[model samples]
Target chain A: MRLPRARGPLTERLVACLQRPPRSHVALARTDGRDAADDALALWILHELHYRGFEDVDDAWEWAPSLMSMRHHLERELEERLRAEYSRSEGSRSGQAGGDEDVVAVLHQLIEADDGPSLADHLLRDGTTEQACQLLRQRSVYHLKEADPTAWVVPRVVGRAKAALMEIQYDEYGAGHHDRVHQDLFAHGLAAAGLSADYGHYVDEARLPILEQNNALSLFGLQRRLRGAALGHFAAFEATSSLPSRTLARALRRLGLPDEMAAYYDEHVEADAAHEQVALRDVCAVLVADEPHLREDVLFGAWACLELEARTARDLLDHWAAA
Target chain B: MAVEEPDVRPAGDGPLRCRPCPGGPLLVRGAAQVQGDDGTWHDTTRPVTAVCRCGASALRPWCDGTHKVLSQRGVNPIE
Candidate 1:
């Protein structure tokens, strides 16, 4: 996962600057980015500095004042875009519970009302082997480090929300079995599928929507101000995963993909069922209960999850249809 | 004479908590094992587990979220 190719002036300067040492007073261009993909990839690279960094990059850059300022700018733009996109859709504020309506129930309502293009259903019904392979390639950008982004929410929460979140995270970290860690399991699946299992391997080829989805997770999790949204995003992710995972497993097998790849989704079928329960009833609900003011932020985060995913699904399906 | 409640408290600071989630599975924690539908003792794998209540899961005794699908179709458990 060396620096991906520059998609625009922002990433072009970012990629070049990242290659050299983080010297003081290095001025970056003031452009927002060339296009949506360009902005997404540039922000993605900036976020990558916080994660396991690219080769030959200085660890100190993770907290460099200049880099942090640049990230703050990109993050603000991305956040504004996500909020505007979500609000522009029908009844965006409907996710907010009315007059003591249960937050968890409202989360369910948000999930149920989502009418996004179902990529899993497409794969199960009509996707070709090539489409499945391409999906897997794009998914590698996140699956290789599954569940890590959400871990940042730990210190920011407390009581039952914190405890419940730990329960979910511990299982994701694999319930005391090295062989069961979700990230490693996905790596095995990727290897079995004949794809590169290395972390950030497909980032260079990832579509803009994929980059946006990953960036949203990083943005929500890393910001203490957005902690409510982070948990909201996490809850939506888990609640929506189980049944679709069942569909994806069948789809992968139907496309004649390797069993190990399907096995990864098989694990999610049961795992996400439990994870969703804890996430909604315990994490999100309790967090909102303990602090009642975050109800809107929680809904906003959940909406971001659904809307961004809808965009990604539409992008891929439309691309395939066009081809 | 008291029958002693079988000393069923878990090995931790408290008794096992088995919470029946409305319209979902039974979320249980701090249990060492559970009796499956077939009467075999199944070791609880994680600290928290969801035991199937909808009876529609292919993975018996453990939920795979089949209840949500059932609810969507207006299907309710008879038992």
Candidate 2:
């Protein structure tokens, strides 16, 4: 995909540097820019280097120390903010388990306690066709490349956890059927709905919350120290996907969207049912059983996943309402 | 038109176990084809497939996570 339009000064400068030949020290203007949409955009662009470098940009820039430092600066802020929010919500270490409780049980408790707004419910009930399409565009940023971030963690673990993580990922990658790859399925859904199926087509249109959601996943997956959080996020993500997918399917049909689009959600209804179990029991539980020390990090990641998703949902819903 | 069955191989030429997940569906592993309630053969496409134990599932023979919804209303299909 071509480079997206720069959102602000940070992305503007970063994009300019990326267009040039790979250099050791392309100085970037310093800014805290915490919670700024531009900050998220710059970080997303930096993370994109590790995934798929832009066509116009030199691939060698992916490892440039100058860009890496900017990425570190932004990630530090995002991680601190996420941890602070997690701590505030947790309020007194009473909710923190000391690796004694079953990790799956703890994950379930967190899932059950999540009283976040449901975007699927809104769409199924009363959301407009325009709103539905808008949400799909925002979601395409990640759905177009689903299950990839977590795949990064596979090499970082061993034993049953390694085997189990692969099992879940195999299904996500379409269980040996290229036609059934989840990302392609989503791309088909987007095309059938008259939206752009090209990867990163919607990044320029995606809101800050959407960008943050994507950034957090990449952060957890890239850091070996955050592998526990990666698996935690994976388990939480799967556990919550199935039923919402059902509602989403119904809403897509209700709004007279294409069957291929609805079918994507339909596929998730069955796939995630199986995935949730393996992710929770086989992957997260087995990993915790082996490491034990990563349990808290697991919980932290799970909470981050749920909280960011909730924020995304609320932001979109509120935007639609006010519009 | 001729139709051929999907190429699938079980881990071994031995019996495979259907491991039940507490509060969820039965997980069958090591390769097999499941016969749906409608008597159609469905190949095990993934490393593990969660066969629906809860009759409320929208997808027969495959769990659609309806069990979690059931559990909310005091139904434990896993039991």
* Candidate DockQ scores, in order: 0.62, 0.67
lDDT of candidate 1 over B1-79, digit per residue (tens): 1110111225445458877777787787885466666667676677788777777777767788888887888784622
lDDT digits (tens) for residues A205-300 of candidate 1: 899899999999999989998999999999999999988999999999999999999999999988888889999999999999898888888988
CA lDDT, candidate 2, residue A261: 98
Cα lDDT of candidate 1 equals 0.85
Tell me which residue pairs clash in candidate 1: none
> A303, model 1: CA deviation in Å?
0.9
Candidate maximizing lDDT: 2
Residues A1-323 of candidate 2: C-alpha lDDT, one tens digit per residue: 88889877888888888888988878786664543888999989899888887899989888888788888988889999898888888511434753477888888888888888999999999988999999999999999889999989999999999998998899889888999999999999999999999999999899989999999999999889999989999999999999999999999999999999999999898888888999999999999889988888888888988999999999998898899
Measured over the true interface residues after superposition, the C-alpha RMSD of each candidate is 0.9, 0.9
